[model samples]
Target: MKFVQPIRDKRKIEAMKKVLKSESVRDYALFVLGINSGLRISDLLALSVDDVTTETGNIKERITLKENKTGKTKDFPIGTSAHKALKEYLDTSSLETTSPLFLSRKGTKAIRREQAYRILNNAARTVGIKDKIGTHTLRKTFAYHAYKSGYDLSMIQKLLNHSAPSVTLRYIGITQEEMDDVYLTLNL
Candidate 1:
């Protein structure tokens, strides 16, 4: 498989949101929830309306699911950005509780992995993101930003369920230049 990079620029992320929201709220919600929750595309797509919303149709404070690859139960709190986007989409959508959160236009099933890839890849290109982008970009973007925001490498590794900090660092695409800056800036 080809390696994909994170959307490193906040401006580009915002641009992607704006463009995607203009086109489809479902797509926008997908992007917002993907980056904020750091879920694999399979887990993200597998979500049902009931997974994110209460029986009364309120957004849930957190989401819990089984990871497709690791077969482990994962849970995380939903951030404000993800909540807002979900509220907007669910309010407008008429899907049932058991229906797929990101439904396909041609059927009731969740959108296929290839469709998710195209949706994100097209948005990245529209935002002038030159890096390789795919469904994995959303997960990597979350890891990258969480690291940049001063979260410890160990914490990020745990979040991504990776085996080692070095794997998390490389998976998030941290560069030699960034590592060098850490040495230069911490001069003591």
Candidate 2:
């Protein structure tokens, strides 16, 4: 499997977001929720409307689920951007409580992982992102920005369900030069 990198350029991130949003609210919400929640594509694709919605059809502030790969439960708060996009999508889409959150064009079931990859790749290409973007890019982007924002490394490791901090470090694509810069800058 070819390695995919996180979107480190803020401009490209914003551009991709814009492209997805302009394309469809469903697409926008999918990307926003993925990057914000750090969920694997399988987990995200498996979500039903009830998973993120209340009985009254309001978006939940936090969502919880058992991960498909790890069999461990994880809960995360939806970020503002993701929340807004989700609300917009919910309002416009003819989705029921049990319907797949990200349905395919036929609306019979959740989209396949391959289709999700195509959507992400097309959006990335539209925004002129030259990186090797793929479904994992969303998860890596979440961890990369979280660590860059000074979020706890242990917390990120747990979120990604990695066995160690070192694995999380490498998963987020941290470079030795960047680590060295952090050491030099933290002169306290």
Candidate 3:
């Protein structure tokens, strides 16, 4: 399969927030968590309410997850934005420790992977993101933005739990144009 590249525009994020329903703060959390935490969709979707939130509605320091594909234990730190989003979502959602972090409209136990894609894609459309944003978009967005923030590829690889830097770079879809521009503006 040809690997798809995620849309990396910051404005798209703003547009997504604008289109999201006020009551569906869970959607907001999903987007924020994916982009900020760099957690895979499976791991993110697998989270229960208690995994990330305290009973008092505060975010925990770290979330421990057993990655499905790799069979490794990974810990994700909670950031301010993700914490805030979680708090807001919890206030409106009836989720419990046994409930999935995301749920279906019927209040079912789980949200299918396809539903996750739609939540992201619909929001991306509101923000004018033209690419085919899918389940993996948020993961790629997190890595790309982290790289732009001056994090090293090796560190990113480790954080992503990738076996190699090349895999991590490819996962984030770093283009040849971006690579070529690195030395174009060098000073004496």
Candidate 4:
């Protein structure tokens, strides 16, 4: 298996959002929620309309689910960006409460992992991102941006459920140059 890098540039992320949004609202929601929640592709794809919305159809404040990979229950607050994207998608689609949030074109099930990968990869390419992107790029992008925004590494480690700081750093594609800059810039 090949390693994939995070979408490291903010402008590129926006460009990707634009491209995906223009293509399909469901695809846009998938990308937005993926990056915002950092959920694995499996877990994200497994979500249903009820998972993210109330019976009255309002977006929920938090999402709680058991991760497929870790088998651990995760509960996270929905961020404004994700919530907005989801609301937009739900408004446009005729999804029932039990319908898959990221439904397939046939409306029978959620889009497959491969399809999710294609959606993200094509959008990345459209945005001129040359990085090796896959479904995991959403998770890595969330972590990379969180770190860049001054979130503690330990907090990020916990969010990702990683066993160690080193693992989190490596998984998020933190480079030696970034580490060196920490030392160089902290000349206090």
TM-score of each model, in listed order: 0.98, 0.95, 0.92, 0.98
Q: Any residue pairs clashing in model 2, and if so which? A: none
Candidate 4 — what's its lDDT?
0.95
* Candidate 4, poorest ten consecutive residues by summed lDDT: 99-108
lDDT for each candidate structure: 0.96, 0.91, 0.79, 0.95
RMSD of each: 0.8, 1.4, 1.8, 0.8
What does candidate 4's lDDT look like per residue over 115-156, in tens digits?
999999999999899989999999999999999899999999
* Candidate 2 weakest ten by summed lDDT: 103-112
The order of the candidates by lDDT, greatest first, is 1, 4, 2, 3
lDDT of 2: 0.91
Query: Which pairs, if any, clash in model 4?
Result: none
The per-residue C-alpha lDDT of model 1 at residue 89 equals 97
- Candidate with more favorable, higher lDDT: 1 or 2: 1
Cα-based lDDT at residue 28, candidate 4? 95
Candidate 3, residues 1-188, lDDT tens digits: the string is 23555657777776776576453777888877777888888888888888887778677888888998788998878888887777788778877776888877776666878888878777776677777788788888888988888999999999888899988887888877888877786655
Q: What lDDT tens digits, residue by residue, belong to model 2 across residues 42-100?
A: 99999999999989999999999999998999888888988998999999999889989
Candidate 1 per-residue C-alpha lDDT over 75-180 given as tens digits, one digit per residue, 9 for 90 to 100: 9999999999999999999999999999999998999999999999898899899999999999999999999999999999999999999999999999999899
Rank by TM-score (best first)? 1, 4, 2, 3
Candidate 4 vs. true structure, TM-score: 0.98
